[model samples]
Target chain A: MHGDQVTDKNLCLALINQLKWDAVCLTSKILECDDDRLRQDYINILNRTFAEQKQAFDFAKQHGWYQPMLAEQTMIGQVQSDTQKMVNEIQQSMMTMHQQAQYQAMPQQQNLNMGQGMGAFQHYAMPAMGHQQQIYGGSPQQYYR
Target chain B: MPHAKGKITARELLDLQSHLMLESNLVGQFNHFARECTDPQLRQMCESFARSRMDSFQRLAQHTNISPIQ
Candidate 1:
């Protein structure tokens, strides 16, 4: 179709799409930039483009040119629950790994005696372990006896 | 302003040149679209977009010391 022959609505819709593309391109440029100054400059431009794109989109929507379906509440709730569960699982795994690392950092003799008894090792290693914790800047937690 | 402290690289110069061109072209296109628009609201929106692009173009040109012509 000839450029001039396109209807106003079609032209506006096309401009909206072009703005979306511009936003994506600007985001990529910001991410790929190595220079701090250039990155900041791109970030500013991206922010302005985002605002303009939203304005354009709202204009189109208000005019009935862009009508998107509203998402179901149930779907949103399900996604929220799923995300929370995944986050909790990740945190549990990280805690377990951190405990393992602390255990490995302990003296081998203490580790061997850990299964049999706790009183002796606790008395022997407490001060040294406290020092180690200070050096590592990790909070001390009681080991399960 | 950030460009004041350090020298701009050759690659950065090229990137700024590209941005300036894009922004100027966008300003032209938006203005053209605004003139073609029959609805007052749509025309106003297009004009706003054109002004925004022009602002971006001027900002980049000012900061990078790269004129649109140069």
Candidate 2:
């Protein structure tokens, strides 16, 4: 079949994909164990898992839900992680903005003495500001004159 | 060559094994094709009978911290 794409390759690849998705997690649990005997035992367990995978692939051909479920599961997990990251980033930005606003307001607050003034500027003026544009020793009359 | 960062993915390991198997088959198929293949380029393809075959099992074993099952 020169130039004719091998159809079996597609099926075989599909089988491999199914095997990886279905069994990889379970296999990893066994593979990750520290015990060598247990790891070998896990490898041995693959015979059943592989057979079951082939059987499931055949079943899924008619049911048609296998690959879609696997793909959807991964995407859903991805969306959740992405949304969590976005939320964290937004919160971080808000915190930074709040800090910056507090810093900017600190100098202004000190000059105005918002704490000591306590609504004094609303309807009343401070004695310091009331002292007009006279030098320290000059009287108000001399300044006005 | 760019090095990979992060734990070796199970899917990646499986894919590597799958590709190795495919290449081995291709090497076997090439012997016959070398005789029949009219294209000089295709005829020049190399054959490897488990000689240069690389398996992910060893690397996987190292990463997983276990003796290779193979």
Candidate 3:
């Protein structure tokens, strides 16, 4: 490639990098959004951006302008194992919390069952309301109803 | 279904504005690159990207109006 063409290719790569960054920022925004419609719109735009990014990447690669390095098998394995370990730790913590909540609610549930009968207690009891609030950052009513 | 029929929250408005800015910038960059590139294939790719970004920009811009929540 000529010097000017090389410069153009480098600029194209830079633009592609910008698109990748934009996609990341858009994804974060989507996660933060509360409105379903707005979130869907953002998701649609994100999908388009991803498709265009892929096209730009392929074009650069086809023209011998950009070549990404491949990760080694060992490095890939290490990342996979690390991710699995983190997931396991999160699961274990969640199970412990769930068990503790259930244990704390057992006495209250039993009292309600005995006083109001099993059917009424089942209808009115919200043993995990507090735990749900803690996790969801909202009132029990907002979640239950 | 109708578009933006529900009331737009402040957060959603901010997100839309941010996306509009990004899309506009992308459209400009892609159009510029398309014009500057000497290779036909690269030029076509850049033009295509510019068009897509422009479409996104228009779609996002349409949501800027505030409406009553249904």
Question: Candidate 3 residues A39-69, lDDT tens each?
Answer: 8777998998898889888878887888989
lDDT of 1 at A60: 84
In the range A1-145, model 2's lDDT, one tens digit per residue, is 6566443334334444644553574465565554454345445545544664565355445444355445678899999999999999999999999999999988975765553434445234345634332223466666557
lDDT of 1: 0.76
Candidate with best TM-score: 1
Q: 1 or 3: which has the higher lDDT?
A: 3
Please report, as a residue range, the 10-residue window in candidate 1 chain B with the lowest summed lDDT.
Answer: B61-70
**Candidate scoring better on DockQ of 2 and 3:** 3
What ordering of candidates by DockQ runs from best to worst? 1, 3, 2
lDDT of candidate 3 at residue A30, scale 0 to 100 = 93
Comparing 1 with 2 on DockQ, the higher-scoring candidate is: 1
lDDT of 1 by residue, A8-65 (tens): 7786897788688777877776666777867887888888888888888887888788
Scored by TM against the true chain B, the candidates give 0.83, 0.44, 0.81
- lDDT minimum window of 10 residues, candidate 3 chain B: B61-70
Docking class of 2: incorrect
lDDT by residue for model 2 (B27-57), tens: 3543543455343432342122112222322
Which residue pairs in candidate 3 have backbone atoms (N, alpha carbon, C) closer than 3 angstroms, thus clashing? none
